[model samples]
Target: MGGAFLAAAVLARLGGRIGLPTIPLFILAGILLGPHTPGVVLLSDPHDLEMLSALGLVLLLFYLGLEFHIDDLKAGGRKMAVAGGTYLALNVGAGLGFGFALGWGTSEALVLAGVLGISSSAIVTKVLVDTGRLGNPETKPILGIIVVEDIFLALYLAALQPILSGADSLSAAVMDGGKAFGFLLLLALAARFGTRVVGKLFNTKDDELLVISFLGAAVFVAGVSEWFGVADAIGAFMVGLMLGSTSSGARILKLVHPLRDAFGAIFFFGFGLSIDPGDLPSVVWPVLAAVAVTLVMNVLAGLGAARVYGFGAGPAANIATTLLARGEFALILATMAAGAGLDERLSPFIAGYVLVLAVLGPLAAGRSAWLARVLPGGAGVCAGRGAGRGGGLTFRRRVRVRGGWSRSSPRPWVVVRLRAGGRFSRSSPRP
Candidate 1:
């Protein structure tokens, strides 16, 4: 285990150094040390490590919430609703159709669709942020759609276990639904009130105390959610999201980042460790088919969303193409499937599918800008009014520059000082 951790860390660093997502490398490290590969024994049984992987997800989502507002969903209300709803419909329909065609049982088919319906917000968001695509005009709708999908995915994961596990009926589902809503309300109240109290109490510089408080809040909520039969990761995410709204969320994020990264690395590594090579032959074709279906459908569905939202074809295509990767939700599905005995035939496939998406998702996000450029009016779409492009110099600025004033700032010192054809320099005060 120690050696495996060391190897995973080294490989992840190497992967980052070479501009690859470190996640796949960690997964690869686990695969190398797993039962499938020869002469390595980092993990004897991956099921034991699954819980921590989940905790890592909680932290990952928690930090994600720190980047946006809960109300942001409402801000993109009409467009997101149309896009998000359509995206879900297409993906879910595709999952069911593909699964049934593949001859999976009803329960198994639903699991397949649910699993494939989920895109990895973590993986996709990471790639966008890493490649600096988050600020792109196309990136906003893509991310907005993801934000909506994530909300649905969270509810789906919580409700899925009971439905698929055959542990409860529709009444249980209703109860679970109620529990979920209640849970969110409680979280909102906490975010509204608890953060201030907790933040003040932990304002001291005791690193250990701060860490403990943070973990304590995370664990407590996670536990409470579980007691109500909700997914622990969702609970953890809510805890983070709520606390993220607080002023201290920034400080907490910095302190927790290293820990989150370390555990997150192990989480992906453990996913690789869970793969049983013995089952690969039986699972490979199905896994590949599922991955193909998911990637293609997600993109198309995203494009449909773009059209409905009134984005030009080029931007829509870019947004759709950018959102075609999967991650956290897939893993959540696998975990639920495992608990429900769905793992008997599908766990390996889920693991492999996630690994593939982890690699491919980033590449897509990195190249989305290039792809957008080639689409009709792509470059100009990001230039004009209401395009959501950041830092574009306006025509007013050009007029100001031609007239020897500044369009953006009124400060005389900051005014344009043009010297050559369209070239400018910093203004200065001199004798």
Candidate 2:
């Protein structure tokens, strides 16, 4: 076991140095050393590793929420809603069509649709951040759309489990959905109450206590959601939405970040630990096809949705192109599939598919500016020509302005003050 882990770590580090995505390499290593692979059995069961995967997801979602601010959602308003809705509809439709053509059972088809409906927000967001484009005029709008999409992804995943698990019929599914809605309503109310209670409770402002309460709120919400049969990611997002509306969220996020990172790293590593190396050849072609189709369709769909939201062609294109990759969501879908008794054959395919996307997605999106320029505003080129030149010269100019007014240059309001003071002190000339 120790040797397997060591090998996995070394391979992952080497893969990263070579610009390959470490996560996929990690998964591959696990498979290679796993029971199905050549003569080595490191991990016999995925259950323990899966727990860590779950922790990774929980923390991943939690941090995603931390990064989100309700103000951003409110600010983006129409763009977020319209783009998110359209993208979800189109991608899910495409997935369902493909699944049906593939002759998957109805339940399997539905799960497949859900899986393809969502993109890897983690991967996309990470790409944006890594490229220093997170707040770029082109990227911010895309990020907003992605944030809204994550919420939808959360809800979609919540709805999917019941259908796939065979735990609910149509009527039962409806009831379960209603129950989720009711719980969310309660959560909303609690969030509202929090706005009032939190302010009063922490009036003295102990940072440690504040951090505890903040995390407690998130974990409590996650637990409640799980108890109610909704996914825990949904719970974490709701917690983010609630705290984000309050003033303390930023500080809370800062406090919990170290823990979130440590756990998140383990989570990804755990994901790799479960891949069965032996199954690769069997599902390779189908998984590759699915991944290719999904990558192309999602990017186009995101672009179209962005256009619908009134983003120019360039930005819309960039946003759409950026969203084409998959990451954590794919794993979640795979996990759900496992619980639902879907074919074990599908897991590796999904993992490999996600792995490919994470690496390729960024490289593709990095070219969005080139795509944007070629398309003439199809991808949200907010700046005019030369705007791409280090954020244009205007922003640099603004930053260079010196502090404090020159004595020779009185404040612009000085004239009005002098006029009000009336008639002239010769020492202070009127404008």
Candidate 3:
């Protein structure tokens, strides 16, 4: 455990200097120090970190829930639905088609649909924070889309489990799906109406007690959610939503930051530990093809979201690339497939596909300016009509002043329109 933390921290620190996102770096550290690699194997079995990884996932989602305000959900309800629906339709449809094209069994195709369709919530949240886009306008939609995906994941898992188990009747799958959906509805009601009760339960003055309280609630709910056929992440997120509505939400947010960061790193590192590099080669072509398909679909989804929200090319590119990675959920699906006696190839194909995208997603999101330039509207397009709604690249010119023209500051041309009602802005002229 100590070695895992040190390895992840060292690699992430080094990667940060080179302008790389920490997620893939953490994962890379795991891969290098894991049993699959030749030198310096810190842990031979990935399962050693399983509980820690799960905690990491829970904390990440809990933090995301804390940050996501209910008002945003109410305000952009329709837009989020539209954006998320578009994303799912495009990606899930493409995944199903690709799966069938592979001539794999129907069960394998079903599994692949989920693996390829869903984005990694953990990766997406980390990307937004790392890139400082958590406060951006498009982030609302991105997070909203993730919420929609989590709901879909519940139903998808319920349905898939029955199929994988070789149940004779479709009624079993339907029953399971209904149960999951019902559980979600119950949780939603709690989030909507149980905030006051929850707040009182957790409203102690001491930070230590507060931390223990929320952590216990999040982990307990997450575990219970899995028992009810919903994703544990969703359970944690719901807990976040409830707690975020309370008066202590801000304090909780500040306190949980370090915990979230630490565990989140362990989560990705544990993911890296599970993968065997030798298994990736046989599925290389399929993985590449899946990656290509995911890229194209994400771009289209981003453009569609931009159009719906009246955003410009820059925000559109950010939305597309930021949500491009596939991680935890894909791994879960791979595990299910392996257990169900599906095609032997599904596991490797998923591993390779996820590894490539997990590394590529952050790199692309950070450099979205390139994609923005190539988009339909140039990068110079106005991001939003009003001040705080959206933001984009703004060009400034050197103006002649009383002193016979003030010297143009270095990189004076471009500025980033922030989300603080356009009250504050930053210059980032670099491409």
Each candidate's TM vs. the true structure?
A: 0.77, 0.74, 0.90
Best by TM-score: 3
| TM-score of predicted structure 1 | 0.77
**Model 3: which residue pairs collide?**
none
lDDT of each: 0.65, 0.61, 0.87
RMSD of each: 6.8, 9.5, 6.7
User: Candidate 2, residues 6-94: lDDT per residue as tens digits?
Assistant: 76678868976865544455556665656555666667666666655565566566666666655665567787677777777788787
For every model in order, what is the number of clashing pairs? 2, 11, 0
User: What is the C-alpha local distance difference test score of candidate 1?
Assistant: 0.65
Pairs that clash in candidate 1: 120-326, 120-327
lDDT of 3 by residue, 1-431 (tens): 99999999999999889877899999999999999989999998899999999999999999999988877877898999999999999999999999999999888888989988999999998888777777777889999999999999999998888789888778888888888899889998898889999989999999999999999999999999998889999999999988998999999999999999999999999999988899999999999999999999999999999999988877788889989999999999999999999999999999999999999998888777778777888546443322122334564444332343233644234444445232445465342
Which one wins on lDDT? 3
Query: What does the lDDT come to for candidate 3?
Result: 0.87
* Deviating ranges (above 4 Å) for candidate 3: 379-392, 395-416, 419-423, 426-431
Q: Please give the RMSD of candidate 2 to the true structure.
A: 9.5
lDDT score for residue 363 of model 2: 63
